[model samples]
Target: MKTHTLLTVQEATALINAGKVMALAGDEALLRQLPKGNWIAGTIPYFIADEGGVESRERLYASELTQVGAADVEIKTYTLDTIKNIAADGPDNGYTIVILPARSAIHTEYANHGRDYEGMFIKPIVGWIAGVHLDDLNRAAPKVVDGSAGAVLAAEAVAMHVTLSADKMAVIHILNLFRQDPDADVITFAETGFSASTCLVNGKPAVLAEYLAAKRIDLKLPLVADYNGAQINTSFQGVDPDGRTVHFYAPVFPGIEYRQAAPVGDYVAELGALADGAHGGVQFSCNCILNYLYGELQGRKTGDLYGPATFGEVAYQLLNQTLVYLDVRSVS
Candidate 1:
């Protein structure tokens, strides 16, 4: 059975602290419950202590800011003390904590642990923590991967790892969806292994536009490209199916700089065709950061720290918004 509720960060943390959630070898039940939305995964590769520099470390966070839509993102900083407090106080305190690390400290710790070390470590680091809320614990638990429990270990086996800016991109995507459909339900799905060019819509093969159409939901698929490759118009699409006329607004990829090279109008039209049963939408997938860097670093790496963390944030936002969209009444 599919679990319909989303979980908040607070609820998830409590579950972890209480030992309500358990890790399994490829737990399908847990994987199935992840929230659904635009999933974006990234990583923070561990460079050799001597070779690693401050500028490179800063670039990781800086790259996140450069993603397509990140302007309205809300970034917060958290410390070990604050995390300990949340563990003690419970979810009512109401805040998500993201840890950012000091480059020098991370480097020194990496040296002590040895270049080939593989383990999860969290202590003085710089990062932000943020998330939306949902009612159920099951739904929220997957969004968080605890480094301490051997659940989300670092790829390079270091003790100090922190979140950078890609988290902001996840936030922006959720905010955009909320702006469009305040009541839409959010769902998150985390990938332990990266798959290429395959996306599942409601457990079926279909693109975003096609899924929207199959449901008979009257909405316009926004054009995202040019018809003749002449010019591009950036806008969001508006639809009123009953009138038989849908309006394609300009393309909007706010906060993100690398715009989709294709014209917005074209993409919208393709989406409409999918809705009309005339075509199928495109499939999309992403590579895991660990897998991408595996060859570059020659050593025994155990797990993916950055990829799972990114998945956790994306899943958190999707599940949070989904509960809001469904207007699920609170349970005592």
Candidate 2:
């Protein structure tokens, strides 16, 4: 079973120094004081703890693996092309936790080459890009920890790649409440890039602003794409008036056509259903910040699911407006 705990900076430092495989979420200042050890961390003020939804800047949320869990983790740090190199060699057959700074150039680079990176690595990854509130977006930057090499501030991504032993295996998946509205007009794009502001609607290049206006769709509702079996989301952030382009929390990939997803009717029931059988053996999990606000998760519980409400979640590739979790179980 996964053990989620709340600790102060000093308490968390002790655990880190004692060699624990931990995933941390808290304020930048609190996390910065932590001692370097076997762990990875992200910045976020919102979380769904064992209790309920709450926001804190003082207490640190930590998920520490036991001795059995510790033995299964091979923590490592990657930067720039190094991530590609590790992925190229094929990481150990298990789940990889990728925690990187939000909105950094490196973040953009990885987003742009997500598919290639996914193809190179043959393991399930469940993590999120670290981020702060929109108010902090301009004043503060996202931070990540490379425990092996101490704390890294700005542009770098720290991955706590867990390679489970033969006896134990990992099951990584996502819980997306959004699905395509088949009746909605199909939206396609010709450009192959991330952070797309303009897309082609029925083969005609049009600004996203005009398209959303014409369709009368809510920007809060993300554009969904079915990637083979997995349903991925591209969430809207806002529009740039001067540029007349739409911005997204996660990049909209090329070639794959996207459609606006339908809104969730019942947040509690849907979230509960999604996490129905995931209570046990769940190792790591996180929901999108968008879900927190849109779902009105404050003071509400979703079964036994809990973790930081991140800006963007990662289930192999960067995703938006979804709940991503990892389940590791032992073979009989």
**Runs in model 2 with CA error above 4 Å?**
67-72, 118-121
- Write the residue-wise lDDT of candidate 2 on 1-332 in tens digits: 33676678888888888777888988888877887677889898889877667788988888775424556666666677666644543346676778878988778877767658744436777788898866787899888877666766677777766766778777777888989888766787766555566778767878878778777889878999988867788988877776577788877766888889987788867886786673557778888889888878878877677889897888877889888888778868
Q: Enumerate residue pairs that collide in model 2.
A: none
Task: Tell me how far candidate 1 lies from the true structure as C-alpha RMSD in angstroms.
Answer: 21.9
How many clashes does each candidate structure show, in the order listed? 42, 0
lDDT of the candidates, in the order given? 0.22, 0.77
| TM-score of each model, in listed order | 0.18, 0.92
RMSD of each: 21.9, 2.2
Model 1, poorest ten-residue lDDT window?
319-328
TM-score of 2: 0.92
Per-residue lDDT tens digits of candidate 1, residues 136-238? 2224322222324323322211111112232221111111111222233221122211111222433444443344455554332112222243222222233
For lDDT, the strongest prediction is 2
Q: Clash number for model 1? A: 42
